[model samples]
Target: MGADRVGGVRRPVRAVAYAASGVLLLAGCASMPDSGDLRDVESTPRQDSQLRVFAMPPREDAPPAEIVQGFLEALTSDDPQYATARQYLTGTASGHWRPEQSTTVLAGGPDIQVDRTTGHDSGDDYAFTLTGTKVARVDAQQSYTPMVGGYSQPVHLTRDKKSGQWRIDVLPQGVVMGQSDFQRNYTSVNKYYFASDTWANSVTSATAVADPVFVRRRVDAMTQVVRSLLSGPTRWLESAVSSSFPAGTALRRGVASLAPDDQNRLTVPLNGKASGVGREKCREMATQLLFTLQNLTPTVDTVTLQRTDGGTLCSLKEDQTETVATRGSVKQPDYLYFVDDKRRLVRIADGGTAAVAEPVPGALGEGVQKLSAAAVSWDEHTAAGVGYDGKSLFVGSLVAGGALDAPVLVSQGKAEGDRLTAPSWDARGDLWVADRDPARPRLVLLEQGEGEPLDVRVPGLKGRVDAVRVAADGVRIALVVKAENGSKSLLIGRIERDEKAGDRPVVSVLELRSAAPELEDVTAMSWAGDSRLVVAGREEGGVQTMRYVQVDGSTPEGPPPAALTGVQSIAATEDEQLPLVAYSSEDGIVQLPSGAQWQKVTKDGLAPVYPG
Candidate 1:
């Protein structure tokens, strides 16, 4: 969410001022207008009242495309010249650099090549898709200065009628880089999953990808329904994450259902006429995430359910069973998932590492908060995770905020190199998890008031446990283990608890198996239904994801018989419908309603979420 002032994006006081601080996004997919027919298009009508505040027609003098090009040239100009660009500027106080910010705008012949241009943002904004091709002029040799990894994709630009002139409002390329880098930097931002393609060099970064190109596609698609909210046809600047999905992909419509198993696991699905490629892509990404991410290596493991006595967590405990894990790769809690009755997340935040993203204004405001406490901190690594018990709600996130009112415990485990990798919750009040810090040794179990004696020494679980989840009805348990080379894997099976292990239970693990594909830094887990589960995991080098669904639809099989791809973190409604999976990578939550259609639920941006 942007802020309290955020609404379907209203108009501006000045043409240029309208976009002040209004992010200019580009996914390297430059969709600009062709030079021929720039002025003929008409502005789209506004849907929401506020979005049309500064709504006005473009000056009769200049074409929409021409106005946008003016700003584009000013940005790349070698010599200082704000003349054309200033004409189209909104002229508001903002962070957007002005002509004065430039020493000289490049003039004469430059490296900009217009590719494709079209009526964008509900026809209210004209756009151009151009490439900053490093073309060698007759007198000069040209070499491409790689953007990010390399090969700058086309840039998408948007033009709007701010007042007398058509002002450039959105920059798809700039927005693309800005948002992607922001996400990459946070390293903590997590989402359900999305489906996709691999036409070229790009791995497509797993699923469909939220790059600029993908975002614009979503924006345009959104216009089909809410045509009025955009007086200027609201531009899809950067982040694909939005509060709502295009009406076509919304979850509230019908067909799909949600179910929660005894262990508090959730299940839901998207049904209808979804393309095989799309579903397949989503599954592929999910599979990668579930099968990878956690650097799990186990020595001794087991799954067992214990009845509770009284407190928030069950009185049961695990005696030393598996060898202590080496290290669990849980960087953020959101990466990990657990089946819950309501699917309550402590706080849903948007952030990334400072190394990549721009400074998040009071980043604290964007994260998950339980009991009304805001947990946001860039000084340390953060994780977003959920805890469900069919009844109670206990969601946890790695924020600098401490509930007990103590100094925020920065990642103590990580700083000392005793990296606390994966972290997750279980069906009951208990959480199947493991975080680490040197001075502290052994695989320990924890909750707010749980007694110390109940904490068990999971044998073979030497260093740490990356990610862990208890299966349906608490019949099975899954854990990501780290091994000698630091390689991680999933260890799933049955566990038996011992009362003699001192009020707590001694542990026994049976039928342990590793995921088909090895995982690196395991994240989260949710129940799919009919006995299957969807786990969210991330590999060291690959994209984040959720995969692995149950087959028999009755038992928690633990590790899956095969690896699933293009999916991450399952939040199904149980056995009824397929599942309502959160596809963060694709910038929304997807579902299979009834084998007939697909629904995408998102919260990328809306008004600011005023904290409690």
Candidate 2:
């Protein structure tokens, strides 16, 4: 789901010229270099072929069971049109089999057992049953759904009269791949969709949102990605989001000859149904194609839409557009702020080296001397911090004449390690905090004005809530909880505001889901983009790693970024360009700009932060 369906906050878009109307995306982790050195280092061959092709065909003299096993293994290959996998089927059966209908992802290699009936003839002697645990299912429409249960696929084989070779004659459509094979062959990609523009013709105000879908890297990826985008959002998001393509919209030539021109401009010809759409609508459709194809081919800088007759529909330059309505539109601030060795608030320009990160001209920046952990508000006007001793929480203005006001909240820890977490502010101006008090653990929310802080009830949390960050949408909250074994877990919970009682604002958590259950320890997390989070956690070995996870509890495929030892805290924003900033005890402040490699920004910095 995109930002539009997040928290029920209707994120509208604004359509402008090509340059300002585009959406920004950080380079994806799925696509690795096509070729690399293999002599001195271990490496897996990159899968870049147009189809899944296999090296061997069905053995001509093999038994029915052997042929069945060969066909199953071939399904996992990059065989063109699955021609090799089809070799185990009769010519007629091969033509009728539809591998694109659906996919069944299993937990492990299938357990296949041969079965032969008593009265079966020579050709009728081939029958088998496959058993395994179903991990997930990708329906014919390409919507993925996680599931858990027993799966059984029955296969029947018959002798081909012409070749006298054993071949499958009865089976279901689509294919099945084991967990290990699936991980190596398939990669996830996000398709872009736009929210309905409330002011389309006059001044467009709807933004594009990314809907992630999986595709085989060695298969027809470009065509599949485009077709999925045109088909619209998945079942879960359709109610909350809208698409720009008109009803009955489709490709003109259907992914064939869909190539970029000499200037690297992608020419997409649609059917006659799209010819009647308005100019603005055509531009919106073009934006969708540009973002969807970005991962496939970065050389495409513009998209030209055409009709079947080759008449031009609309064209959009890549640089002239921006995805203004989604969370990606929250551009990075002029500088990242952090506390220096002197315990004072300081700032640095985005790319580093513009100037030393000097203290700002405000109370917290110039006046305050002692600080431990802190966070800045979205507008950069206010700052919240924990006292040097970690017992008190204070809030003050970051403006020129602001003052370091008295502590607004405090906690009495039973031990030196039980302290309050860095306070985080949401878009609605509400501050959230969690006190790791063994005796009285609580998660509280503070409204701007002079009202008593309200405690949020989380039903299923096992231990103390260590950290709480409210999403920009104000409808979801991420919590880092410390379990009884001292390990930490990262969880995402839905924030439900009770409106029936009119006395005061009441918020509670209903459906809490484990966002990164595989990680052993979760240290920190921040909203990287709409519906996506960047988390700092450690696997079983206890080595720190960073990963990107969806709020829906699904993790993308890829190894974690390079290790950063002693990361005390990490910060990220909805802006995709800001990068992942962390405060390391060994190196002070370090930033992973592309989420792949880390670089030092400053040695004197302590708690680095970007506006939430």
Candidate 3:
């Protein structure tokens, strides 16, 4: 045997002090026991505290090329009305330039090339070609749309002998900003939209979807958000959502100016066209404006809509228009459930009514052993769980002794490492799961537990499926797929049901598209509204973070409502007002109400979930 493996023991020596003899002695002993790495502490990460504001670019005489570069850089600054940046433009062009028409966000600084073919003399003109990667587009209404392509901005400059300065004579209608400045100077905002089915009688019951757009944080954000709302949803979500603004509807003037009245209510002056809308429609329009503006500021308690011709259309108080749809379902769930440290399914009522998450009454609630992941049904009458062993899946009622006689579904994993992800319930009462077995990665659907499990084939998918969440409409599915590159991504696919496969409709993935190309590793996700999803993922080489993203792969501009550190799982109801719940290793179960910080709801919780 080798000396290390034999009976011989290694030792470390230490120095010892002998006060009696006034001398130091060396001592030898066995090696000290090895200690493990230190455990990490739990706390919210420090937020960015540095103040950020836009500054005006310096006004100085310079060459035509230099002036063009300076003017381009100035457009990124937060100068009020872009006054300083306009200095590089001729007097006529400066007044005509409309930066609000569009904002082109580029991936990097523009590569500019000035053609000096013409002699540099007074009244001589030079053309500059600017090229860059366009990442996003902010339209006149301030709606943000992600685009992937190259863009060229050509501008003409003229030399002014009087000032010995080069000024821009002709240019594009909008401005361009580098990615860094675009993120800090602009913010994502949500404009309220109602379901397309909304009618006079269904207005009270209709749900609202939040159409996210990017707007200048320091500019008139409230006005921009409202104007975008009036313009309707983005093209990606136009098919799924609608605006109450009637056809050919427009502000009384070009853009309405909003001011607060003595009662602290916003008075909006629209053009005569607004008066053409009926009283009920006008009230609904005001409600939409109220909801959109409230997210920016709370000073305005009501909104008064009037025509530029001095005629009042309608006025609505914020509190009086509470029935408007913006988030989740009409009736919010009362409690959110999750598995505790003991692997017992428990629930915490809203408002902290329940000090502890008592075991749910049903068999899976308290009696089920070694439960790994669980999801509550839409009706809240049943739940589906994955066994801790990662093989068996159980579905049962929420009442006492309501579990099925045996596990309804069983997955085959080559090793203990293979596991089944959490189950998600769709509005049609279907339970969806992905068996993450390397040998057989597939999506399985259980139709309300009334029939056998069906394997849904995702045609053209080259990676293994991790998790899936079906939308309320039952036609779309949000999937987290592990790519061949060893990273996970979020993809949205249409669920096509073919009637040719016997009595039950056969489901298959079709027209699959990336939902969040920005996220490199998608760990968890949930549907937040009609056309958006709250995703938990990490950027390339970045820590995991949560944010709202459109189904079409566009990120919203607003920060995540809460900080999620070491969060294992998260869940939220369809209703926007319902508190968001998550399970963190350090904080246990945490809940966050609208506009509130995360609050610990319980200790030692995991896989928090809400009713479908």
Number of the top-ranking candidate, with TM-score as the measure: 2
| Cα displacement (Å) at residue 311, model 2 | 4.6
* Model 1 per-residue lDDT tens digits across residues 278-316: 433333322322211110111112212111221111111
lDDT of each: 0.30, 0.68, 0.70
How much does each candidate deviate from the true structure in C-alpha RMSD? 24.7, 11.7, 16.6
Report the lDDT tens digits of candidate 2 across residue range 206-298: 555566677776566776777788888875555435778887777885446466779999887788879888887787788888877885677
Give the candidate order by descending lDDT.
3, 2, 1
lDDT of 3: 0.70
- The residue ranges of model 1 lying beyond 4 angstroms of the native Cα positions read 1-411, 415-428, 438-443, 447-449, 461-463, 507-511, 515-525, 535-568, 576-578, 586-598, 605-612
Q: TM-score for every candidate vs. truth?
A: 0.30, 0.72, 0.70
| Candidate number that wins on TM-score, 1 or 2 | 2
Lowest lDDT block of 10, candidate 3: 36-45
- Please name the candidate that would achieve the greatest lDDT relative to the true structure: 3
Which of the two candidates, 1 or 3, achieves a greater TM-score against the reference? 3
